[model samples]
Target chain A: MKEIRVFSPATVANVNCGFDVLGFALDGLGDEMVIRKVPEKGIKITKITGAELPYKAKENVVGVAGLAMVEALNLDFGFEIEIHKNIRLGSGVGSSAASAAGIVYGINQFLETPLSNLELTAFGMKGEAVASGNEHADNVAPCLYGGFTLITGYEPLRIVSLPVPEELYVTIIHPHITIKTKEAREILPEQVSLKNAIKQTGNLAGLIAGLYEADYGLIASSTQDVLVEPYRKNLIPDFDFYKQTALKNGGLAFGISGSGPSMFTLSKGLQNAGAVEFALKKALKEKNMKSESYVSPVSKHGNRILEQK
Target chain B: MKEIRVFSPATVANVNCGFDVLGFALDGLGDEMVIRKVPEKGIKITKITGAELPYKAKENVVGVAGLAMVEALNLDFGFEIEIHKNIRLGSGVGSSAASAAGIVYGINQFLETPLSNLELTAFGMKGEAVASGNEHADNVAPCLYGGFTLITGYEPLRIVSLPVPEELYVTIIHPHITIKTKEAREILPEQVSLKNAIKQTGNLAGLIAGLYEADYGLIASSTQDVLVEPYRKNLIPDFDFYKQTALKNGGLAFGISGSGPSMFTLSKGLQNAGAVEFALKKALKEKNMKSESYVSPVSKHGNRILEQK
Candidate 1:
């Protein structure tokens, strides 16, 4: 029997400019899952996770995703699944997406990779119904495919995986704090002013043009958010400092990560990602808070196996 | 001396699924302005629109737009300006936007086209301020340009004038009944559910992708509006038939145009456009509702002067 262990990186949705409409994966932060086909009747989850998760097997973040594959493939042999979580859960770092990615990735392996990335993402998004009670693909698509991806219409994914610009750098700061994604969602205003939506449309358009045209300045400028950020920024520690400091150090734009206590910034020509990492650290410290910061390129591939036995 | 006269089309801001974000210009409706410049030293508002106007030269709808132009370029010129009427005067089809567009267009010509289209539109958006007491561009850009445009951002619009896809067609129906744009604006609920916003985000994302990829099927499906349409559709007369009939034909998408009394459908093929328009006219006739229907392709240029002398 072959046992394979894999990891899928965390993700950030909205990306400031593309609020609720765009997302991408990170290379490092995420979760791990291991699975092995066993000589059993039907596939089932064997363990919960490294951290306590809700809803036993059915509520299992990645478990539901694996179930989808089993149902779709009409599998007979059961498989044992185990998960290891690394990303900060509920920090808007796509913690749930990692587990879901693991299930989809491992099951694809078990199924001999029958489904395409689009199909796999569709099944994985069903797992979102368990995690967030919403079948949102912003985080899941990127974690599955990597890079800056636009999840337009998810039923076949219909993802547009945009090339990460050469001059781009990203900085992420995860504060050692808990801000429930649901809680973050609760604070959002029901109706945004028409003006903000218009602005967002333009910014998102510019952001897309920037990516295609390789106009860093336009992308940087377009990354400003007006709708969700103004309401949500009040929850993040050192929100203004993290952005201003990072920009001063070479970052082009900054905004909250998903529904965040974690925040991120984009940069142009800043090679030493650590400078941004340190800058955010300093800002958090000034707020009497301690947060871990990450500086890495946008993940180009979403989930992958690290080892097999 | 020479006289220059032109018409600007009314635009729908916050395109259905893109609430507060996307807008498009429509043909067959808007405001008209006439300008004649003489080798003189001053500017004069010789005649204001006689139609159901706001009733003053300085405070008139088109007057504010003219003010934005003179102030922007710091140009002093002797000219006689006249505001005329057409377009559903109070419909959300950017009734006031035409005024803004006219003022800017008139000034540009009167000033010998010193300002580019970019500068002219910015000057035009000030007319929105006259109407809503706020400056906005979704209406002005198309009113000034004469085609489909993407208003990417603001202050100075991050605008993109895009090519309308050859397959795309629009069917518009204007009922003889009146619904003031302001009254329609007041009908919007003060708050919207977060769930709805999330749905809209998905729809908006899908719509943008559909337009970009030229996937008429997706565009049709993604044109849904969970937040605004349900509430506002109630205001239009026989909206259901208009919507269903359009879709039953070859229409890819259908929704209320701007505020009320008008509805539009996007079609992937011209056959669908004609069919939808035919169906709408037929339905209106059945209801004994006097109405006008048009099957026009998406305007490629928003506010270009067809002729000037």
Candidate 2:
């Protein structure tokens, strides 16, 4: 194929007790990209829409990731990419990750020997680092592999795909606010009490087991964050109210999605997720806060080709 | 049944990547107890053997745990317990936990309505606290519930039973030395760096997933401790040498069993475990360090009645 169109889903990182180690992708909410082979010998960005982003190959996340992939493979042919953003930028919902993962995923389809999703994640992370100021995999991993992803280790970049419950649903609320990933990260304490550290590990381990067993009660009890939420919640408006509303309205767990301004609730079924969405929107409305919200089942697949020729 | 004899297996608590949260029971090494109903109104420890321990009802771990269980249920009858110690004290292999769990397990057999294993763990922790200076459940939970146990929460005492691979084997080496649990706990840092804490959570989550999927490779990579091992390994003589030897000899993972002195290695089969045992013994002997060793599969059941009448 000389050209291909792909869809890359957004993701929720720093999940509840998982902190920097776990994440999951969202269905039907992400970025779209169209890439075509050109006669030139380098990567290029031709068109942009739905959001303001740099067109320069060196400045944009997609270009950065695509270039990294191209340079690593030493391709003599060039490719031009058209950008379409559906997930908002700086929303803490892996906006940059969707774009970066989409381009690499799209480019891979054109090659006779396509890189594995795992290999693509490395290039995706190169682009992700441009936005977050550090190389982290929680977002790009789930965005690449789909379902629930646990970063087992970093030295060798190990990623494990955890089982997702059939009834699992995700509800996301992005308040009309912005929290930079770098600043959100900076606000966290460098040292955590040994006691809380143990608690967090217990919760994370329980969450993993709960997912495997499909035990909702176990998931509820384990979806608590003792490390990062206390500090980042201050940057978001009425964080406690949103969390209480989500849980009170049938959400199993509530926590900041990624670095914040955006929040997510995990529920058992789509009906319960809708209820959480309705309740959270009403709560935000009562406070006169404008926001965007969505409900989706956890995405089963990450980046997928929409069209190819 | 008015009388029962029970067996409570020894356990390796504070497992790698699961400090203060994970543990597993041994197959054959444990404590044995005999309990009988009497006309009296309280619990009593009538006999002691194989170790020097207090005979006073309140001063003994078995008595403390039995009394707590009886008081909680408000039983109108009392029981007498005969103790036989096999696992050494202060061996970091759940010696006290076995005795404590044995009495409650034995007492439950005499009741028309036996308590659940989960409820029995609470009483076990009570007796365990007398020895460890804290109500930590890592050892007791495994001793009561068997296989691998994870303490997911402390406030409500949530315990989770994790899967054990069919071929998984355990090799334990208890050096001829002693390290008190309280002193070992005191040596831990009150605070841990956030980076290492996240790393620990990742390893633990991976370990839980590995156990469920029976993925030995994942277990090998995940069985590492960064938070507590650095500080505690110094207390155990030649710990690094022992660990290297185990890893070199087909052991999947190696770490301290609990606080110190005893170290455990996990391997995929009986032969691998035996190999690790031989290698570890040879390494210890070369250094003129005396130690006792045992090899067993991970126990499937916790406490069991050997005789009832």
**Alpha-carbon local distance difference test for all models:** 0.73, 0.91
In the range A1-309, model 1's lDDT, one tens digit per residue, is 378999889898888867766888877777887888887744466665557775356767777887777777887776787777788677787888778877887778866546787788887888866878888788888888888887665544567666678767778888888887778877878777654554555567667657655678778777777778888888876677778888887778888888888888887755746677777788788888877878777778889889888
Give residue B26's lDDT in candidate 1 (0 to 100): 67
Give the C-alpha miss distance for residue A99 in model 2, angstroms. Answer: 1.0
What is candidate 1's fraction of native contacts? 0.28
Q: Pick the candidate with the highest lDDT.
A: 2
What are the TM values for chain B, all candidates?
0.87, 0.98
Label model 1 with its docking quality class.
incorrect
* Sliding window of 10 residues with minimal summed lDDT for model 1 chain B: B193-202
The interface RMSD for candidate 2 is: 0.6
TM-score for chain A, candidates 1 onward in order: 0.93, 0.98
Runs in model 2 lying further than 4 Å from the true structure? A38-40
For residue A277, give model 2's deviation from the true position in Å: 1.2
lDDT of 1 at A70: 79
Query: Deviation in angstroms for A212 in model 2?
Result: 1.2
lDDT of 2 at B179: 87
